[model samples]
Target: MSSTPINKPSALQADKASATTSANLPEHISLSKWEDSGFEWAGQVASRSFERLNALLTTEHLQSDLEIKANLYRRNNVLHLSFTLTGEVWLTCQRCLQPIAIDLTDDYDIALLDNESQVRLVGEEQDCLLLDEIITEPAPERLLPLKKLVEDEILLKTPMAPKHDDCEMSVEQFGEIPEEEENENPFAALASLKGKL
Candidate 1:
C-alpha cells in the first residue's frame, strides 16, 4: 500500500498536482492496512468532482477547490477516522433569486466497527460507523471508498436553505402583497340588504 508523507515538501507538491487533476486517494482503500500504519493524506479536490453535490449548486463554476485532510488509525482495538474539509460552493439564495457563495468547513471523527453489534461495545458517547455501510465489495477483501465518505460529509454539512448572511429581503423577488382598497367592501351589500329588511 502506498502512503503519502504528511510533512514532506515533495509529497505536498505531488498532492497539489494530483488534487487538481484527480483525487490522490485510491477509489477503494484497505481499512486494515491504513488502520495498522496510521495512514493520512491531505490535499485539495476539484469541487466539480463531486457529481451529487453539483446537482444542488446553482452554478457550475466554483470559486475554490475543496480542501481535505484525513487520517485513519486504531485506538484500543477500534478503528477511528478523523477528517477535515473546507471549501466554497455556489448555492441559490432562498431569499433572493441569485447565486450566492457559501463557505463550508467541517472537522469530524468516527469509530469504525465491523458489525452493528459492536456499536454498543464502543460506548454511546463516540460516533460509530459500520464497515458494511462503507464497504462496496463482498467478503474477505473489504475496501472502503474515501471519496464517497468525503462527499457524504460535505452533503451533511450543507445547509437545507442556503442564504447569504447579509441578504436583503426584496418585495420584488417575493411579490408584494396587494393592499385592500378601503372603498371596496364585500359586506357593504349585506348591510344594505339588512337595512331594507
Candidate 2:
C-alpha cells in the first residue's frame, strides 16, 4: 500500500475518455472515472484502469447479484487499466458461525493484460508496457478477461457465510459445549459436625 498511493478515481486515464470520445463511449459511468489505471484482455481493445475496492480482498461474501466496473487506457505501447467491483454476498459469522448475509462493495487495481497475437492481459499490480518509440511489431492490443477476473475475484473474496464474534448457543441449552465442573463438599452436613468438634 506504500508504493501504491491511494489515488483518487481522477488519476485514471478513463476520465479522459469521458471528455474526448463522447460519441464512441457508451452509457458512461459517472462515479470517479479513473484515467491513470489500465486493463487488458484477449481479442478486446485496450483497457482503462479499474478502480480498486475499498475493502480487503479476503474471503468475504459475494452478493447473489454481482456487478463490477472497469476502465482501460493505452500507455507505453501497452494497454493499462483500473476498475471497481460492487454487489451483495452471503457471509457466516466468525464467532457465532451463523449466516450473516450482507452486500459488499469492493475495488481492484488492474495493471496488466495478456496480449498474445490478439490482446494483452492485466493483473492487480502496477503493470506497465512499452507503447511508444517501439521498433518491434505493433504491440498486441491489451484486453481484460473481465468475466474470469470477476468470477475469480468473487469466488476468492466471497465467503461461504458471514460470522459473528460470539457463539449463538443459548444459555438454557449449552449445545455441544460442556459446562465447567462445580466445586462443592461431598458431605457438607457431616463436615459441619466435624467443624463444631
Candidate 3:
C-alpha cells in the first residue's frame, strides 16, 4: 500500500519522522521500522478476503500470528525489495483428517516498481515480483502478509487422500477368500466331468 516503497536514506538524506507514524498502516497491525529495512508487522491478514484459506484450513482459532520483514533499495526511481515472513496455520491431516498445525518461515526475493509504467503488468500481483533495478536486496522488516501466505501453503500441503496408513478394516469387513474357489480351475473342472461320465 506504500507507493514510496522503502529505502535506506543516508543520514544526511533521511526523511523526517513523518514516515514512521502508525497512521501509515492498517488498523490490524502493529508496525516498527528498522534502518535499511522498511516495516515489520505481525497479525492476521483478513477474514473475508482470505475466506478460501479459511474454508480449506481450519485455524486453531480465527487468529494467527503473521510477520513480515521488508526493505527496498531505490536509486534513480528503481526499487528492489526482499522479504522474510514467518507464521503458523492449522491444516487438516491428509491421512487421518486430524488437525495439523503447520509453521511457516519463508524468504521471498523480489523487485519493486520504481514508478507507474506500461511494465506494471510485469509483476503486478502476488505470484511474481516485478523487475526494476539490477541490484538484489535482502533486508529484514519487509512488507508482506505472512499469515495468509502460510495458510495457503498449508492448504497446498494437505494430502489428497485422507486415509490413515495405520487404520485397518474389522475382521468381518475384511471378509475371507473362499478356499474351494481358489483350488478349482475351469480346466480342472472339465477333467473331473470326463471321469464322472
Candidate 4:
C-alpha cells in the first residue's frame, strides 16, 4: 500500500533551536518539510554503536558499523514513514559473558497522525498502528526527533538474551549437572515383614 523512495539525499539541515554536536545523528525533523520534499536518508552512523545503547548494552565502544535508511513521504493527506536498518552489532552473550556478533536488520512502515483522538475520526479499522501492520505516531508539533526513532527500532531488534549458536563455554559453567539419586523399593520392606510373620 505504501512505498519509500530509496537513495535520495536529505534536504533537511540542522536546526538552530536544538543543540547538536557533530557526533549526534540528525535529531529532529519538521513533518511539513518532510512532506514537501519527501525526505530520504541513507548512510552508516558510527556514533550509535552498542556503546550508545544505555543499559541495554553491557559492552562499550564496539564498532557501530550500521547502515540505515529512512524515507518519509505524504500520500493522500496521510504522512507515511518507512525505516530500514541493517548491520552487525556486538552483544554480551548471556551464556559466556563475552561479546557475540548479532545480525541486526528491521523495517517498519508508519502512518502519522496529529493526535491520538484522530484515530476515532479515521475509524478503527483503518489504523495501521493499531493493526500492527504499520506504525502510527502522534505529531502534535509536526516535529519529531529522528535520533530517538532510529534508536528505538534498533533497541526493539536487540536480543533480550544474546547467546551464540555453538556456545564455547562449558556446560558446567552454564548449569549444574544433575546428581544421581539412589532408589529404595518400598515393596522390599513389605516383603521382609511378611516373611517374618
Candidate 5:
C-alpha cells in the first residue's frame, strides 16, 4: 500500500482564494448568456480603479471601495439589468473648496435595447441603455465590460456640486465685506441735495 501525503492550504492562501473567487466579476460579460443563466454578481471594487470617476474627485488616492451588485434577467422578452451601488467618495465642497465626503446609494433598472427603435417598446419611463452606445470593441454582439457599466453608474450618481449638509461659507473665504459709511455713499448726498433744493 502506498501512502499519499495531504497538503492542506494555509489560512492566508484559503482567504486569498476565496476573495478572488467571490469579489472578481468577469471583465467582459455576454448579455445573452448572463440573462439566460440568470446571473447575479456581487463584488467590491476600489474607487480609484475608475479613472474618469477619480478625475472628478478631490484626490486620486481614495481608501473607500464601491460595493456593486448586478443582476441580469429577461422580462417581457426584453433584457433588463438591475444594479445597486453603495460607496463613499470625496469631492471638493463647492461652497468652501474643502474636501467633503459623500455617501452614494443608488439603484438602476435599465432596459437593454438592441437599437434605438426598441426604446419605444421599453416605454418612456423605463431607463433604456442602447447596446450600440456601449460597445467599444469589435467583440461579439451584446458583450460589454462590466467595469464600464459600474463606472458609468457611479458617475451618474455623483453630484455635480457636492457640499457638506451644514457647510457655511465663512468670511475667511472671501474676506469680510466692507461696511458702507453714510458719508461714503454718493446716493445719500444726491438725496440730501434734492431735499435742500
Candidate 6:
C-alpha cells in the first residue's frame, strides 16, 4: 500500500496566487485606446469590499475577503463593462435581529457613453453610463478610473434591505400584538345619556 502525502499551501503561496490574479487588472485605462483598438482588460481584485461600496451598503463589518472580476472591452462602437463580484457580506437579518453572512455574486453589464446628449438619445431603452468628462470632438486621450466604475456597478446591485429568506422570527419582531379582548366604546355611554334626554 502506498501512502500519499497532502501538502497544504502556505500563506505566501496564497498571496502569490492572489497577486497573479490581480496582476493584469489596471486601476485606470485610456479611453482612446479602449475605443480605438477595442482593447480588452480583465482582472481580479481581493480587498475590503465595503470601502469601495461606500454608502451603497448599509451593513457594516463585511468580511475583508472580497473577490471581483472585471472585463472591459469595446464592441460595435460601444464600450462594454462586465463585472462579477463575489463575497460574504454581513447584514443584520430583519427577522432574526442577528448578523448573518450573505453570499453575494453579481454579474453586471453597462454600456459606457461619453456624452450627456448620447444618454438622452439612448434613454431607458438601453443601459448607459455617461462619462464624467466630455469626450472632445476629437475624443482626446483621457484616462478613466476603472475602480470607480466597478464600484458603481457593485453599489447598484447591493440590496437595500438584506434579510434571510428562512429567518425564523415571531410577529413580535414587527410590533406587539394587540389583545383580542374588546373594550367598551366611549361613544356608547354618550349615546345612552342622549337617549334619556
Q: For candidate 6, give the lDDT of residue 78.
A: 58
Q: Write the per-residue lDDT of candidate 1 for residues 1-197, one digit (tens) a residue.
A: 32333433464456445544545544555665455555566777777678788888886345578788877766656777778887778888888768888777878778888777777667688878888777857857667677777778788877889888888866654677799777968888999899789
Leading candidate by lDDT: 1
lDDT of each: 0.71, 0.42, 0.44, 0.61, 0.70, 0.57
> Model 6, poorest ten-residue lDDT window?
1-10
Compared with the true structure, what per-residue lDDT tens digits does model 6 show for residues 1-197? 21111222255335435544554456566765544433334344544433665443334555445566555555445566666777655656777767766566777767777665655544375677766642323435677666766766665555667677887885545678778998899899999999799
Candidate 5 vs candidate 6: the lDDT winner is: 5
TM-score, every prediction: 0.69, 0.37, 0.41, 0.59, 0.68, 0.57
Which pairs clash in the backbone of model 3? 69-141, 69-142, 70-141, 70-142
Per-residue lDDT of candidate 2, residues 31-51 (tens digit): 122223432221221111222
lDDT of 5 at 41: 67
Better by lDDT, candidate 4 or 2? 4
In model 2, which regions exceed 4 Å deviation? Answer: 1-64, 94-97, 113-144, 159-162, 166-197
Off by over 4 Å in 1: 1-25, 120-123, 173-197
lDDT, residue 114, model 2: 34
Model 1 is weakest, by summed lDDT over 10 consecutive residues, at 1-10
Q: Over the stretch 1-197, how does candidate 5's per-residue lDDT look in tens digits?
A: 21111222355235434544576555666764544444556778777778898887786335587787776666656667777888888888888788888777788888877787777667788988877777777865567677777777788888898887898875454777799776776688898899799
lDDT of 4 by residue, 1-197 (tens): 33235423443333321322233456666655665556666666663443446565545537565777777765555566677777777768888887877777777666666556446544354524422222235555556656766776677777889998888765555577789897898798999999899
| Candidate 4 weakest ten by summed lDDT | 12-21
How many clashes in each structure? 0, 68, 4, 0, 0, 0
Any idea what lDDT model 4 has?
A: 0.61
lDDT of 6 at 125: 55
lDDT score, residue 128, model 3? 34
